[model samples]
Target: MNIEFTLNGSVQKVTITSVERALDVLARQCGIKSLSGTCFEGQCGNCLVLFDGKPVYSCLMPAFMLRDHRIETTEYFTKTREYSLLYSELTKEGRSLCSSCHSGIMLMGMVLVRSAPTPTRDEIFRTLSNVHCDSISPDDFADAVLKTIQHLTTARKIP
Candidate 1:
């Protein structure tokens, strides 16, 4: 099957088998390495991609499933102003110390913060629980969430 969609802001058309996973097509064929594939069982959030603006596990979504939808991966996040601010805040606070799980957790945190600016502590815990970054302490995650909220709040007030 031939699938055409905007990948990281570029219009791409690729011929892939119906059974092939979207992660494979994006990483191997389309040269999108940020969509990391680990467990391939959907348990790990490493293969996450924003499908039509909502995050989805690309490893579990077939290539044909994305035939007509927009797919935004981590690469796209790097180019966005919102994500850039989030990244800067995360790094400045030393939240990037968890090198192994930094990317996935950071991405998840950024999305959650944007969608729910004032998420409760429990909500923040729930969101971070899905991540496998054992190196990150719960307190550290909470601190990051709070810091992100502060950043967003200040940014909103500036303009």
Candidate 2:
């Protein structure tokens, strides 16, 4: 089967079996270094990628399911202004996300903030629960995400 999609702003066409996972195609065939299938069962969220502008676990996504979809990986995500601002907030939080979880966490945080005008703490916490990293406390992570939302949505930063 041939799967056609836009990957990181480029149109990509790959011949893969219907059973092939999107995660394998990304790292092996497409050379995406930021995402990988750590826990092939889709529990870890390490293989997170935006499919058609929505966050999804690539480990469980079939290659045949990608026709006309738009995939966003950290390769393109890191270059965005949102990433620049979020990275700054993440740095100030003093808790570093391991490489495997960074992209997933960033995507999750961005999605939550963008999905609503003002997401409650419980909503942010609920979405962030998928983030399994232990280096940062949940409160701090939520705070950082909320702060980023404030900064992006308003001209003023939260003090």
Candidate 3:
């Protein structure tokens, strides 16, 4: 089936099989390599992407569902101010993350911070838990998320 959608700010019209997964279409047709995970199931956040301004596991999303939808990957998100805030916060204090999980964490952080600029630590932890990676401890994740929220809150107060 031929489907058209907005991918990373670009409108793309591509042909895909009815059974093709959104992840496959992204990597093959749109050339998005930042999405990867050990589990192809939705359990792992490795294949997370912004579907219609919300995070969704691309691995389980069928290509048909992508039609006319706006999808944003880490590749596109890295160009935004939110990405900058989350990236700097996540990498503070010599912390590091693998490419796949890094993308997942960054995207999740953006979502969390955007939706709730002052989320509780438990909420931050809950969001972070979605991305199953050992790169950072739970406390560390919450710390960075809180810091990002602080920055955004401070920025919003400015003229």
Candidate 4:
């Protein structure tokens, strides 16, 4: 069957099998390689992607369920102004994330920043606990949320 959905701001129609996972369809069929998940059962947040502007594990999502849904990966995030701020802030703080969890952490961070712009450190760490990545410290996640909130606040006040 064919699933019609928007991918990174483009309309895409793909033929996939129900048994096929979204990770495989996105990577092998659509050539999206940024998604990563060490735990295929969805324990690790490595293969996270935006499903209708929310985080969902691509590895665990069935391909056919993607019909009419909008999906965005790191490729779209990298082009976002938030990503720029995140990169700069992480670099300035000397907290660089590993490639394994980049997509998941970054995307989830974006969602967090957008959903809750003024998250406290405790709240930040609480959210960070949900994202399972050994290399990314809670402080690093907190910093990212702060940077993203700063960027959003600044962007809002520019007018």
How accurate locally, in lDDT, is each candidate? 0.75, 0.79, 0.85, 0.79
Q: Residue by residue across 84-153, what tens digits does model 2's lDDT show?
A: 7777777684657777788788887767656767778888787777756765667777787788777887
In angstroms, give how far residue 15 of model 3 lies from its true place. 0.5
Task: Give lDDT tens digits, candidate 4, residues 82-144.
Answer: 888876766564666777877777777776776754878887776566468777677877887
Off by over 4 Å in 4: none
Q: Considering summed lDDT, which 10 consecutive residues are worst modelled in model 1?
A: 93-102
Q: What is the TM-score ranking, best to worst?
A: 3, 4, 2, 1
Give one digit per residue, the lDDT tens place, for model 1 in 1-159: 777988877899999996799889988999986667778887777877778877788889888887878887766777666676666765664545465456667667766777754888887787776666776676777776677778778878996
What TM-score quantifies how close candidate 3 is to the native fold? 0.90
Encode model 3's per-residue lDDT on 10-124: one tens digit a residue.
Answer: 9999999989899999988889988875698888799999999988899888889999999998888677777788888888888888776888888788777778447888888
Which candidate leads the pack in lDDT? 3
**Deviation from native of the Cα of residue 46 in model 2, angstroms:** 0.7
TM per prediction: 0.82, 0.87, 0.90, 0.87
Candidate 1 deviant stretches above 4 angstroms? 92-100
Model 2 segments more than 4 A misplaced: 156-159
Clash statistics: count for each candidate: 0, 0, 0, 0
Candidate 2 C-alpha RMSD relative to the actual structure? 2.8
